[model samples]
Each structure stands twice: as structure tokens, then as C-alpha cells.
Target: MSLPHTPLERVTSIKRKLIILIGVAVGATIAVFYVGVKLGAWPGIAGALGGVVALAAVWFLARGLTRPVREMAHAANLITRGDFDVRVSAESRRDEIGALARAFNRMAVELGETDRLRRDLVANVSHELRTPITALQVHLENLVDGVESADPETLQTMLDQTIRLGRLVEQLLDLSRLEAGVVPLDIRSFDVETMLQGAVRESRLVRPGGAIAVRVDPTGLQGVGDAERLHQVIANLVENALRYSPTQSAVEVRATKTHEAVVLEVLDEGPGIAPGDAERVFERFYRSDAARSSEMGGAGLGLAIARWVVDLHGGSIRAEARDPQGCRIVVELPTAIGAA
Candidate 1:
């Protein structure tokens, strides 16, 4: 049943309001008892009737104070059943219950966001796997039905698809390990120039004709971190740049040392990321240009993995708009005090 509205509802502090209601109920009871005795009623009967009057007054006056707690209890039960959308209407009050209600709402919002990410993860992984699996299945079916010959060229194409599927699976496992904090970092000083050269060579092999340029300030700049993981970071950055960069346009990779940090950059001359998508581009499977990203066979996990690795090294990474056009991704890692 709904609480009967009382004048004490306007009070902000529940403690003070409850005290006042109790005082009023006691005063009403005493007044009623005195009136009955003045009318020549028996003292015992008058007191009993007065006690009933006090109980009724309390029931009417204090019900509103407990209503919010009841609402929260109901909301909590709903939340336990996976209903993150449930909300209590107690925040409109200026009481302790109101603060609790606001906190509950914030928790609900975070839970909803986490649930959304989980759902998206499953859906995106399925979609990414389906594309390559579908291609392989169609080719194999054609060959089996004698509709097409399994020539050297056809076999190579199927092999490439198989390799792509393997790469995706491997990356997924790598990312899982990275996220689980199980991948041990082998931190040490390494030559930034050598790392860039190796990454560039790999990129060249992947796209033979794409132009990739690298520059390390001071000619032999060094970084203090896990060399292998750092190499993975640069390789992913370079690969992303190569995939999006226009033909004949060079992807620039630069490494420079500051007073306390070693900064790495990759600039690509592709259609730049939208301003609204700058931060979100690092979220797993979140592609700003979904159609183009799918066409380029990007699973959108590279930057997310890079961010995790950089975060593990106590470093920071961000995206920026390059001059005139294009995008620049900057990764900054702290340098050891005395390391080169």
C-alpha cells in the first residue's frame, strides 16, 4: 500500500523528522488521555484508548520514511536477476536514502556498459570468423563438386585464407594472454633504430610496394622496455598504417627521446579518423568506418592490444590528426634514468 503523505515529508533529515513524529504522537496521546479523564471516564480505559491513538498517529506519520528503502530492496532484487535497467525514484529526496539511490544508479550504468561490451565482443568475433570461414568453405565446395579445378593459383588463394584465419586466432590468443596479465615482460634497453628497421622489413614483406620511412632522432636512440613486446607494438602500428595508407604515400615511423620519455609515432596518409572516434578507436572491435575496416580485413584489435601492452609498461598512447590530412598515433614510454 502507498504511504499516506505527511507534513514531515518536507523535512530533509530522516532522523530529525522521525524524532519529531514520535514527539507529536506522544503529545497527542497524552492530550487524548487527559480529555477522557476530564469527561469522567475510567483511568485504565482512557489510557488504553490513548495508546491506540498514538499507534495510529505513528503508522500514518512514519510510513513515508521507509518507502524508499522498500523501493531500493525491490530494485536490488531485480538487479540480481540481470535487470540492470531497474531504477529507484528515491533520488528526488534530500536524505541519506537519496544519496544511496544515486550511487545505486551509477552502479547500474557501469554494469550495463560492461554487459554491452561482452555482447559486442561475442558478436564481432563471430562476424570476423565467419567471413574467412565462408570463403574457405565456398572454394572447397567448388573444388569437391568439380565445378572448379584446384590449380596452383586456387590452392594459394585458399592457403592465404587459411593463413588469415590462423593470424586472427593467434592474435585473439595473444590479446587474451595480455589482458590476463600472464605475459611476462622482458624489460631491457634496446636500439630503437634496429627495432624500426626490423618492423619496416616485415611491413615491406607484407606489402612489397608500399613505402615505409623511419627516422630515429640522435641516429642511435634507445628505449628501455621489453624489446619483443615493444617490437609488437611498432609492428602493429606500422601494419595499421600500411593497411590504410594510400598507394605511393609513405607511412612515416619516427622515434624521439625526451627528457624522461621515449616517444614513438606512426603517421598514415589515409582518411583520418573522425574526431569523435579518436579515443574509442582503441576499444576492441570498435571500428569508426565499419564497412571500410571490414573490407580491409581489420579485426580492430591491434590498437586495443597495443594500448594494453603500453599500459603494462606504465606508458601512454593517443591518436592525433596529422597536418592537412591523415592520422598520427603517438606512444610515449618512460625512459630509464641512466639508460641510453
Candidate 2:
């Protein structure tokens, strides 16, 4: 992408300035001809010829300058009416108009992407919401009709569906809050290892027999950030690891303190994310073909929320294929000052 033209370039662009200049010149020529006719007949004929020539020049210049803008204006109207595919043929020009064309193309691309994501979000959310709600309705109906109810198994299933619905709603709301930037980060310094241990414990609760190994470079891997939010980030990563990994496969948590930052990695022995999906895995409502189990996965919001929290603390999070097997999620955060 070429840099946008500077103010100096805009002023100096002869082609861009000529469109206005042509209109003014045509008007001046006509005014001179009108005055010359009032003065004398010969002067009027000569002035009229000059005015006619100027008018022709203006017509050509107007077509060249205004055609692209007319096309763009029509396309913009279509876009406003919910058409995202309309494109203008102005990118080939090497002037201010070309810059406008490129910007319009970029806007169209972004609007198209946003519209697609919006549709996907609505579909996914509806599907996710309906599943548990349908299950609950069925269970309630059965109980009301006296066809079922005293059994512990049936009750438990309904309870599980309710829990699932609640979890999904909570995650969606949290995601909204984070994205809106209303959730403030209470920054502070604390022991990151302690938070890691807590997250590992939570993951173990999710999968009782799964192993979560922690490997820290230094004794106490201290970090500085909102500890509670960081814990949520860690737990989400660990839960994702457990959900995809085998029953007894080990998930590793590695931590190290660098010169100016604290780095943590969560490694899972599951089918790793595909290269194409690595960048998009953190997108809300996104599911990949590389996913271990499409039906069994969470509402596809965990990684997105985790990323938001990490970013809140001036941190970066990324995922990659683990060596030889599995997937790795790395989180890097800036360390607070003067902490040993």
C-alpha cells in the first residue's frame, strides 16, 4: 500500500487542481466574449471563437476528472444500500483520484469482512443458544406431562444443559465488555507462578485425569498485571488444551522471565491448529477445520477473551504448531519495574 499523499502533494497535483481550474477558465472566457460583443462586432467574433475553444477544453477535462468520481459515488450509494461487492475502476490512476480509489477499495473489503462476520456471529449464537434451550424445554415438557421426572439421570442432563447455557451467556457478555473497553485492568505486580498453579488446578477440575506440567526457568516467575484477569486467561488456555488433548495426555505450562518481559506458554498434545487458522483462531465465533471436535468445543470465545485480557496488560498472545506434535500458545507480557 502506498502512503497517502501528503498535503504538499495534494496542493501540487496538477491533474487534481486542473478540474477546478478548467471550470473557472471556461466561465472567464464566456464573460470576456459577452463583454466583447457589447463593445464591437469584430471583437465579439474573435472572443466567441476563443470562448468556444475554452468550452471544448473544459468538456474534455470534465469527463476525465468527473467520470471516476461519478462511478465512486454510485458505488458508495450501493454500499449504503447493503451492497459490499461494488468496486470502482480507478485504482490504475497514479494521482489523488487513485488514492481515493484505493481507499474506497479498502473500505469495501473491510465492510465485506465485517458483514460476513456479523452473519456468522448471528448464526453461531442462535445455534448455540437454541441447543441448550431446546433441551431444557423438552425436559420441562416431559416433566410437566408426567412422562418423566423422578430419575436422577434425566434431572442431571437438564441441569447440565442449563449450566452450558449460562456459561455461554456469561462468556458472550464478558466478550462484549472486553471489546467495548469498559473492563478496566487493575494493574499490579504479583507472582505469575501462583496464578499458573491456580489455572492448572482449574483445568484439572475440568478434566480430572489430564496432566498439566509446569516448567519455569527461574524459581519464582514474577509478573505485573491484573492477576485475576491473567488467571482467567491462563485457565481459558488450559481448558482449551484439555478439551482437545487425549484423556491422559499431558499439557505443559512453561514460564520464563526475560530482560523486560515475562513469557508463558501453554502446550497441548492435541491436533495442532492449521497454519491458515493460526491468525484467526482468536477471532470471536470462529471455528476451524483443524478443531479437534466441532460439536464438543466451547462457543469459540475462550481464545478471543484470553487475547483481550493479555492485550489489556500490554501483552501479546499467539498460537503455533507445537514441535513434532500438538499446539503451543505463547503469551508475552511486559514486566513491572524493579521486581526480582
Candidate 3:
């Protein structure tokens, strides 16, 4: 993460240390000179020279001690100026100061990550909010200008847009609660097939013209999870498929028991997700250019929410391109006892 730029306080700590070192060095030299003069061991001039050498040695030692301090101060200033990349190269002398420097570097790295995530969150939220709001505004303005009458069809379309906006708001609120750890799961054991059937049935009701199909292994795959949330997960995936697949193309939902888990897949004949975008598609407010412009109703939070629900249940979900055409989303969850 990039460090923020801010001015750092000047380092005045070295001044006090320099004063102490100079005073000690001067006092030791004076004492040696006085002793030499009293003992008459050598000429006074020779004793003065020896004292000078001793003071010089003290000065050199003081410089050695303060050099690292000077470097550290410079680094701190760079960091304060939002340069998190700056690092102190002091050796691991097993000293407290060295440890503190290492810890400071780590904290900078974490702060950068936090800042990046915060920016992404805000951008994604804005994009998601704008799409539906813009659509509703345009439609409302047309009606106000008498471009569209209050006919049943026009009124119904406007009502649908309003409902879509409301749903988007609700989904955003739900996602916020889930991310904040405020939503608790009602975990229990249930037949995965039963849940899948219900979700497929509901989706069919909404897109009756779509040729969506469901297939199950019928081996009675069971899982421990919040059934309601799991149902939502299935519905979201299927609905996504419905939105992307061409009219008359089939959206398939399938489930089978793996060795250690139950795998559920929603496959569609729509243009497959680009390999580069497979993972990012699960991110909040991420949509392909085609999907973004399509009339499918969504705020781009469905996949993110589904992933969260699966994660809460100790499961995993991933998307991959299907052979020849389309994309497949696979969800794996631990199988209930006696089902494996």
C-alpha cells in the first residue's frame, strides 16, 4: 500500500546526548591532566597531548553511537510524509530500537492495506448505487414531461424500477451487516437437493420464458448450514445465469456428492467469464461490460453476498469457464453425517 505523505517532527533528541558525551569527555581529560601534573610523571606538555588523544577517542565513540539515531530520524520523517516504502537497514543487533523499527514497518504495511480496501469499498458502493438510481431518474423524468403516459404498462415499468431500487438498498444493508459480523446464521442439517429444488422453482416463476433446468444425482446430498441462506445462495447463482444466458438457452443447476463434500454447480450457456475476471467477478460491484449494460436487475452484490454466506458456513465457491462455451460456478460444502 502507498504511504500517505505527511510532515514529520524534527529530531532534537540527539542534541541532549551530544551534550552529555562532550561533558564526560572534557571532565576525563581535565582529571588526567591534573593527575599528571601532580605526579610529575612527564612533562606538562606531554600530559596535555595524552589528554587530547583521550578526548578524541570519546568524540569518535559518540559519533558511532549517534549515527544510527540520525538514520532512524530520517526514516521516521519519510514515514510521516506518507512514504511507507522507507525502511531502516540497521542490522539486527538484537537491540530494542531495532525491534521497534521492524514493528513500525509492519504497521505501515498494514495501514496501506487498510487504506486500499477502504477506497475500493467506497468506489464499489457508489457505482452500484448509481446504476439503478440513474435508471429510475430517467424514467421518472420522461413520465413527468408527458413523454410517457400513466398507462398500465408504463406505470408498471416505473413500479418495477422502484422495487428494484428498494431491493438494492436492502441487499446493501444485508451485506453491511454480514461484513460487520452482525448477522448470525441459523445452522442446521438439511437435504441440499430440497433446497436446490425450491430455489430453482422460485427462479422459474420469475423468468418463465427462460429454458432453465435442474439436475441432481439423487444420492441424497445433505449438509449442515442455514437453509434459508443456502437457498438465497442458490437463487442468486441461478438468477445470474438467467441474466447472462441468451433467450431459449438453458441454465443448468446440478449437485453431486464428492468424497468429502457436496458440490453444487450452476452452469450457463452465456458468454463465459474471461479467465482474468473469474475471481474478480465475485467481488462486490464487479460486472462484465455486457452484463452491466444488460437489462438484468441487480446491484452487483449478489455474488459477493453468496460468497459470504458460503464462507460463513465453512464452504467454498469458485467460477470457471465451461468447455466450448459459458461459465460454471461451483460451491462445495461439507456433507452431513452418513451422506459421504
Error of 2 at 224 (Å): 1.8
What is the alpha-carbon lDDT for the whole of candidate 3? 0.76
Q: Point out where model 1 deviates above 4 Å.
A: 1-40, 184-189, 274-276, 288-294, 336-340
Clashing pairs in 2: none
Which of 2 and 3 is the better model by TM-score?
2
lDDT of 2 by residue, 1-340 (tens): 2333332233435555675666656676877677777776577586877677677656544455556788899999999999999888878666777779989999999999999988988898999899899999998999999999659999899998988999999999998899899988878888878989998898778767576798888987778888899889999898888887787888899899889889999998888788889989998877676463566687788999999988877789999998788989999998863332
TM for every model, in the order presented, reads 0.84, 0.81, 0.73
RMSD of each: 3.7, 5.3, 7.0
Tens digits of lDDT, candidate 3, 196-297: 889988777766646666777866767777889889899889888887788778888998877877788999998988998888888887887777777464
Best by lDDT: 1
Candidate 1 residue 206 C-alpha distance from true site, Å: 3.0
Which is superior by lDDT, 1 or 3?
A: 1
Choose the strongest candidate by TM-score.
Answer: 1
Candidate number with the higher TM-score (1 or 2): 1
Q: How much is the lDDT of residue 11 in candidate 2?
A: 41
* Candidates by TM-score, descending order: 1, 2, 3
Query: Where does model 3 exceed 4 Å of error?
Result: 1-96, 145-147, 293-297, 336-340
| Residue 244 displacement (Å), model 2 | 2.3
